[model samples]
Target: MKKIFVLDTNVLLHDPQAIFAFEDNEVIIPAVVLEEIDSKKRLADELGRNARQISRLLDGLRDLGHLHEGIELEGGGVLKVELNHRSFLRVQEMFGEMSNDNRILAVALNYHLEEIEKEAAKQVVLVSKDVLVRVKADVFGLKAQDYLSDRTVEPSDLYSGYINIHVHPSIIDEFYTYRFLSIKSVPGASKLYPNEFVILKDEMGTSKSALLKVSSDGARLEPLFLSNEAVWGITARNAQQRMALELLLNDDIPLVTLSGKAGTGKTLLALAAGLSKVEDEHKYKKLLIARPVVPMGKDIGYLPGEKEEKLRPWMQPIYDNLEFLFDTKKSGDIDKILMGLGSIQVEALTYIRGRSIPGQFIIIDEAQNLSKHEVKTIVSRVGEGSKIILMGDPQQIDHPYLDTVSNGLTYIVERFKNESLSGHMMLEKGERSKLAQLAADLL
Candidate 1:
């Protein structure tokens, strides 16, 4: 049965191309949604960019037919800019204020009433990204749903980048002796991706095991190149961290992604490998670190001082790790040390747009806050001889429109799992401290 989907303003703002995602269902854009989108088109951030894109898309659709009445979409549904269904009588008593969300709800309510009056089979559904908006929709006795077309994978089904395979005990001994094992030798390992880590366990129920990574060719599993040696005075404290370091230090794998909880050392490990590659190995000319400026709690509005001063609070986590790595004694020593190094650059993710970064080791911290489009823009900016590492905890997203499965970090991890030049590892253990680990697991 053909359905009628009333889209909220945030749905379009979250994804400009969400109009075509309903697949032959009639998509209705309430007049209030357009007004909200127009209000955001003048900003300078990703939201503004998306607002503009959606506006232009709607304008282009106008040429085909009258949008106010209805236009046949390419997906076999009708697209309409609803202007006459702004009645708030249905929700005026329940929601007194004629706010934008209520206005959108009013439009959906009107359609639902019309459908009932005519005994129509078409289902009227309100699609939104806001939780409260959906709740309000339910209060009006309307069917509401979240816009979920952008999610690359379900949270439970997200790729972990590592798997354990139970094999004959001799197979582990063989891997130790030859330092190489073919994927065919392991049962139920036919679907492994390139560069995915594997733990070969004893099939006899023993604790013996061997850690190996799938070769880039996806043909065999090989031993890790890096031994127990420390990278910039930081060594892996757990098996997953070791896997992350292997991917981080390998120059052949140009793109690496790490996802873990707060104190799992995602940022610390990336910074350590970046420093080692830039300062010791000389493989890259500079180390560039960046993170989104999304705040955790109520924003402090703005800060006083220069550009570095404004970024200090957002980049403090990076600075903390850098200071520890450099063994700085005083508070201002990190700034002086950074000035002396001349090879490390820490900046906000905003400045990274439209710039081609080459011959540098780039690390994007807290990448879970970024949208899929934002991640694509950042990754596409990588130039020749550059390596980029995106690390974050998907479960801790701060973006209003992003969730655990829809953020860019999870998207990249799942999308690039099959690529030869990409490697991913989800760190499981937190090495920060026992207290931190306890809080992460229990609280």
Candidate 2:
């Protein structure tokens, strides 16, 4: 049956193209949603950019017909700006507020009543990215759903970058003796992707194993190219970390993604690899590090200082890792070290837009807070001879509109799993400290 989807303002902000996502379904935009979007059109962030894009889209639709009267969409569905259904008495009495959310609810409720009166087969559903909005919709006895069109994969089904295969004991021995194994030798290897790490375990149920990575051609599994030598005094303490290091240090692979729980050394490992590539190997001219400025709790707004000073708080995690790599002992020693090196740059993600970064080792930390469009924009800016690493914990997203399945980090992992130039690893063990690991696992 054809459905009627009432869009929340956040849905549009999260994805300006969300209106076209509901296939052949009638899409309704509450007048209040347009008002909210208009209010955000003048801001300087990603929200403002999305608001403007959606506004332009709506304007383009105006050429076809009046929006309030309903316009035919390319997908054979009607798109309408619901102006007459703004009656708020129903929600106002129940919620005791004249807010925009309640107004949107009122529009949906009026639609529901109209559908019922006409005995229509169309189902009225409210789609939103806000949890509270969905809960309030349930309170009104309306069907509410999350905006899930942008999710690349379900959270449970996400790719883990590596898999264990129980092979015969001789297969492990062959891999050790020859240091290479054909994918045909492993069962169910037809689905293996380029650069995917494989752990060949003993089929006899022993602890004997060999770690190998699929070659870029997806034909053979080869030993890790990284030697036993540590990068910048940091060594992988776990197998997952070692897999991440192999991807990070391999210049042939230009893009790498690392994800893990808090204190799993995602940032630290990336920094170490970047520093080695930039300073020791001279493979890159500079090491550029950036992260989104999303705050964890209540934001301490309007921080004072220049651009670098304002970015200090957001980039402190990067600085701490850099300090550890440099073994800085005193306060402000990192500044001195960075100044002397002249090859490392730490900046906010906001300033990276529209700039072409070349011959640099770029690390985008906390990438889970970014949207798909944002990640695409950043990655597309990479110039010749540049390598970019995106690291974050998808489970710990700070973006209100993004979840583990929809965040940019996980999106890239799944989308580029088959690409030869891209590699990804999900670090499972927490190596920061015993307390941190315990808290991550238990608390």
Candidate 3:
């Protein structure tokens, strides 16, 4: 049945076209939401971008009918700016003068009151990205929910980015003798993506072992038993990282996002995959690496040189990964090679806007630093034949307004999971060192 969805400002900021996302359902934009959008439009970030988008969208809609009176939306339902809900009599009694949250809550409360009096009216649902708002709605007896169309995984299950599974001891011998095993018919076997790791254990739980991916062909999956590879040299002592690597290196999975402690190898394996694709498979034209210039609570105000020089302190991690890939003694040597071959480019993510990139293996590290708007700008630039990977430790996120759950890494993971043009893994292992892994767990 069709219903009315009251949109909070945060949902629209998180996704500008959110109004249209709930197709055929009436999308109600509280007057306070527009006010919020207007206030955010001048901020120099994602919120501003979304504010502009909403402005443009509302302008486009104005051509059809009076926005004050509501317009029939395409397909079905309506889009209206709720004006009647501005009556602050009840809200002022409880929360006093019209604050933004109270005004917005008043709009929802008014809708609830209308539903109570009206017969045969559709149910009113409130959508927000704020927990407090949802709680307030519950207090007012209005049906409310978090706008979770963008949450990728549960916080408890995020797992630095890995998973592990166990199989029979005989299966292990089959892996040793046959060198690989297929789980198509195996009961309770995970539908592992390519490059995901599996900790095969005996059915009776006697023995445990690890298996990596070679390829994915439905039930006829192939295994890469190369435990000797440096990538797998660091064992996933915890089940979380074991799950994380299973997600990271899977070739069938073309995109990945990783977040953990500082040394969790989020940048390392992405560089590894980008290197493998560029050097070994010739699958992409170049490995384009980028990350937001958000300093870890420190600005580069007094840095020397141009914007490029200014970005150096922020991009040192990219250089570090490149140094590892080239096995070079100095960053200067790697720069020379990158210049000669033109197969690698490391630069600020800011230039990604208004450009379409094709046939490239792209990695956006530290993605949690990006605002929801910045992430959207980067994603819309994915041209044909390109794969974009985003990874970050959300727990250590640098964006002031973004937490582990609201950051772009998790947002992309949730958005792209079911798409055929995309596959994603979350790498969880700390290949840097034992101390690093210990710090990730302890600290």
List the candidates' TM-scores in order: 0.97, 0.96, 0.72
| Candidate 2 structure quality by residue, lDDT tens digits, 161-277 | 999999889999998899999999888677899999998889899999999999999999999998666889998898999999999999999999999899999999999999888
Q: Which ten residues in a row have the lowest lDDT in candidate 1?
A: 294-303
- Tens-place lDDT per residue, model 1, 1-443, is 89999999999999999999998999999998999999999877778889999999999998999999999989898899999694687798998998999999999999998887775568899999999999998887899999999988888888888999988899999999999988998887899999999998998998999999999999999999889789999989989999999999999999999999989999889999999999999999999999888822222347888888888999999999999999999999999999999999998887788899989999999999988888999999999999999999988988999999988899999999999999999988889999999999998
Error of 1 at 336 (Å): 1.5
Instruction: Name the top TM-score candidate.
Output: 1
lDDT (Cα, 0-100) at 152 in candidate 3: 60
Best by lDDT: 1
Of the two candidates 2 and 3, the one with more favorable TM-score, higher being better, is: 2
Give Cα-based local distance difference scores for all models: 0.91, 0.90, 0.70
CA RMSD for every model?
1.9, 2.0, 5.3
Error of 3 at 214 (Å): 6.4
Candidate 1 residue spans exceeding 4 A from truth: 295-301
